[model samples]
Target chain A: MKKHNYSAGPCILPQEVFDKSAQAILNFNDSGLSILEISHRSKDFVAVMDEARSLALELLGLEDKGYKALFLAGGASLEFLMVPYNLMKEGGKAAYLDSGTWASGAIKEAKFFGETVVVASSKEENYNNIPKGYSVPADADYFHCTSNNTIFGTQMKEFPSLDMPIVCDMSSDIFSRVLDFSKFDIIYAGAQKNMGPAGTTLVIVKEEILGKSGRIIPSILDYEKHIKAESMYNTPAVFPVYASLLTLQWLKKLGGVAAVEKLNNAKAELLYNEIDRNPLFKGAAAVEDRSNMNATFLLNDAAHTETFDTMWKAAGISGIPGHRSVGGYRASMYNAMPIESVQVLVDVMKALEKAI
Target chain B: MKKHNYSAGPCILPQEVFDKSAQAILNFNDSGLSILEISHRSKDFVAVMDEARSLALELLGLEDKGYKALFLAGGASLEFLMVPYNLMKEGGKAAYLDSGTWASGAIKEAKFFGETVVVASSKEENYNNIPKGYSVPADADYFHCTSNNTIFGTQMKEFPSLDMPIVCDMSSDIFSRVLDFSKFDIIYAGAQKNMGPAGTTLVIVKEEILGKSGRIIPSILDYEKHIKAESMYNTPAVFPVYASLLTLQWLKKLGGVAAVEKLNNAKAELLYNEIDRNPLFKGAAAVEDRSNMNATFLLNDAAHTETFDTMWKAAGISGIPGHRSVGGYRASMYNAMPIESVQVLVDVMKALEKAI
Candidate 1:
């Protein structure tokens, strides 16, 4: 069976990226040293760090725009704590928009450091749509939002340009689409989806947004310190950063973010169209807010569930089961997910409907 | 030239461990999936996590001793903060022995959470010797110490048997020797040194010592939470843990820590004897406290520096340069370092002496 992976991270990466990364692990850049064994400070690995940081900026088209990129360990979960620790000061409020589970998680951590205000939330609707018309308070230090909800399959179509700094968690759909990167004061993502692997996280912060928090942040949580250390504050998540660098290089070779978004849209459209037409399935999120990255849906009739699952499994599909909270199906069509895989899924759904 | 990797951390590993790890990164356990692409929640990676955590306890001789082992992201640097975050309480003092750089770093973070008392320190001697006859206060909530100093080449030959909890930073020389597993309440090591590679840290904690701090620890920093979640509290440093698992398996196959320790001591003795015997070289640390893992030394005559350096470089030595705080040389002979490599380094020293 031809494998079609749709796991929600440590997710899909370009096959070329995986091949190159595997080679590097064996003998990094012909250094005759396993990438696993080399010093993080060595010239070979340092070049990897430099390239990963610079290429991240280059792909976001944020280079020379007062933004610095960093590769750090601890993933987006750590970033939840760090964003508030570095940006939200004592006695100050940070506004948040809670659309789904990850957004609520961010809010929970931010409250530990300072005052957190949820201006709007879609949770009352089970987070099936993005929160609308949220007002950012002028006195708030920063406004936090999750750009995409991985489990609920809802993506923010337009970011709010607020008077305060805007921090966004773009973990699942980071490079899958084009975005106006300049609007974000800070952007962070775990490298498991649309980037590379799981160990490292990418943090891009605009310089001016730092140093105003007036709280004593730990060195590990301090963004300025990491930026000053060139992301070598401690021995970094080396392999993941190197793998992400390769993916960034692949993104550049495929004509950068704009080019990749086109294919992503085509893939999402193909799958969603099949879901709507077949009557056997229905889309989970609001049609306008449906993620082009993760397409969440469900079998219209519960009786078809086992049959459809068996069909997809026989066709070599994996990780299509939705999060327990959502209780349906989520086909994550990340950047590395080719249109053919979407076609395979769409064809399976059609076949199931025709047989019924 | 053949490579001789002697980096202080991210140092060296058994060739078979590296070979097996490299294969897993390409196709983990023949799952036909790159370890990089697989979901950590999958059965394949879950087995990896289970094996790594279990083998860590087995190698430490702490299995079934109520100690829980966890693999986490961030190196020992993060452990510096986590140790205090989980164990130290408000208005209580934690006694510490400041042996070297990492111990001081651990002290710095501990102070943030509680009153820290430095019971002893070797800073007066430029950290070249481990402090002796230090009293661990009974009233202190815990006693913290660094077991080995990578930069200074000092190792604690014996630990203080105290009434309170004992936390050790064994980042430099973990598993290179045997010890009474029940003596300490907590042991943490970065994977880069004697274990495997950079990125992940191994944390072994006694179950009873946790949840006493009364501080609201973040989920990422809370040891109890990680233990309860079986180190799946967050996505782990997958590749590093996988690599470390292979190294641990290699250790067990080589008859475990007792066997590896013998080889480690022989390698260290080979290099230290050369440092003492060669007219141009001298060992740095006090003889009794010198580390078996990192053997720090200096050139007696500065003028011979270039000649000696050239000799070692020509003989395929790498990363033997001493840390800036203690300059000259540091030949880190970790568990995986073969006695032949030490012989090669010793031969280089003798060749330099003959040429002079």
Candidate 2:
């Protein structure tokens, strides 16, 4: 049975991308070498780096704009440190909107390099909705925000436009919709979610925003150095980058983000509608702020929990368990997740409601 | 034709390991999901992390000997900065042995954290030999060295026994031989040579050596934090770590490092003997300090270069081109390289001599 992958990250990739990446691992470009063992500097791998970088910008409609895309190792956790290490200067302050766990993580790391002001937070409500009506300080170096809360299942429908540089952590929802790309000076995503695998993080930074922090950044942590080296400043996570490139190609062939967003909306609507109509389940997040990518819900009566869990397991569904803090269910419908999988989950919910 | 792999890093891996890894990428442990898309926190991947960590220590004969092994991102280059960040104190100095490019790189990063003393170096002699009889300072925080010079083909036959902590960059020669595993306070190697792939780096550190620097260490660069996190401090490079786990299992099944050493020695001897006898070729490094992993050599007559290059290419041997700085050929005979492949290279050398 084809299991529906709804894991928050290292989640579903396009089937074709997975197939091509598997073939590459066996024999990369017929070089008789596994992609795992090929040098990052090799021509085949270099082409992968080039294509992945360009496709990211192209998909965001930021191609030929000032944005430069980079594929790097260490995931978003590393980016949490690097973003501040490279951008937040000594004695400077940055504004952060803490929507959920990842937002708090970024805020903690940024505090290590400089003063961080929580412009707004939904923490008071257990992050069940996106914060609003927070004022961005004019003196702040940059405004940082998480576009989607993977744990709370809340996503900002629109970013707050500000004159200062805007840095967004789009880790869980980058390619799932179309966003105004030029508004943010920096955008980063952990590849495991919507991009590729877990090893490489995708960073798209405007070149002008770097080196303004006046801190003596370590070369490895320096964003400018990575861009100068074309993301091969060190031996890149070659296989992950190659897999990400294949995924970007798949995204492009699926008519880029615009086409994928239509399917994503439909998938979310199917499950959200089921949760609304079925008496056994209730939605976890506010209806206005709920994430189209991650849908969180729980059994309305609590007695049907075991029955619903077993049904979903038998239905060949995986990773629908909500974050421990929420204690319900979270189905992360990334761009690669087909609508059929969402239908499966909705059908399970409807059947459980009828049977219970 | 089945080509022989000899590329330095991201070089070669066991055929069975490749097969198994490729299968995992398709459907990991019958979970009906690609390993490329599986969550890093999943039981399957966690098991891989556990097994790989234990196997590394077991193969090195350091199991339960106060050494903790961790898999991290960014390769050895990241370690160059992290080692000093986590180990060297604000007012202290560390001694470094500048054997080759990587060692020099480490020395440079260490200098950024604190004062560095070059206790020993062979840079004047083009790093063709490992320095001996250089005194390590008793007051230095730690003594750092590179066990193998991939570019110049020099290998330290024995480590300098000292009371101070010993940190080693064993990127090229790790797992190719058996060494006194307890002697070093820290051992780090990029998983490209003799291990698995390019994205993940293996770090084995003595627990007692951490948290002594007193400087504020970034969580990502903190070795103690990574060890506590069991190398999943963040989303690790999932595919590379999985591939590395497979390679480590392959090493353990092949009688561990002790058994692999015998074959490694044999392969080195076969190629070194051929280089000595062939008038067309001359070894680059000092015979006493030559690496069993990388054999650097040049044609005795530069005029025979095209002929020798053609002969090796025709023999289906790859990755023999030496570092541009060395301007010769480097046949890196890593652990996964079969003796039959080395014999083929030897036969090509002999054929070139005959034809010349």
TM-score of each: 0.99, 0.98
**Best candidate (score: lDDT):** 2
Q: Model 1: chain B TM-score vs. truth?
A: 0.98
Give lDDT tens digits, candidate 1, residues B1-356: 67887888788788887777767766777766778888889999999999999999998889999999999887887888888888888777889999998898888878788789999999999998999987877899899999999999999999988899999998888898999968999999988888887888999999998999888888778888898899998888777788888889989999999998888888888888888888888999999999999999999989999988888888888989999999999988888878888899999998888998
Task: Give the C-alpha interface root-mean-square deviation per candidate.
Answer: 1.4, 1.2
Q: Which stretches of candidate 2 lie over 4 Å from their true place?
A: none
Candidate 2 on B72-151: residue-level lDDT in tens? 98889889999998888899999999999999989887877788999988999999999999998899999999999999
lDDT of 1 at B49: 94
Off by over 4 Å in 1: none
DockQ value for model 2 = 0.76
Measured against the native two-chain assembly using Cα atoms, what DockQ does each of the candidate structures obtain, in the order listed? 0.69, 0.76
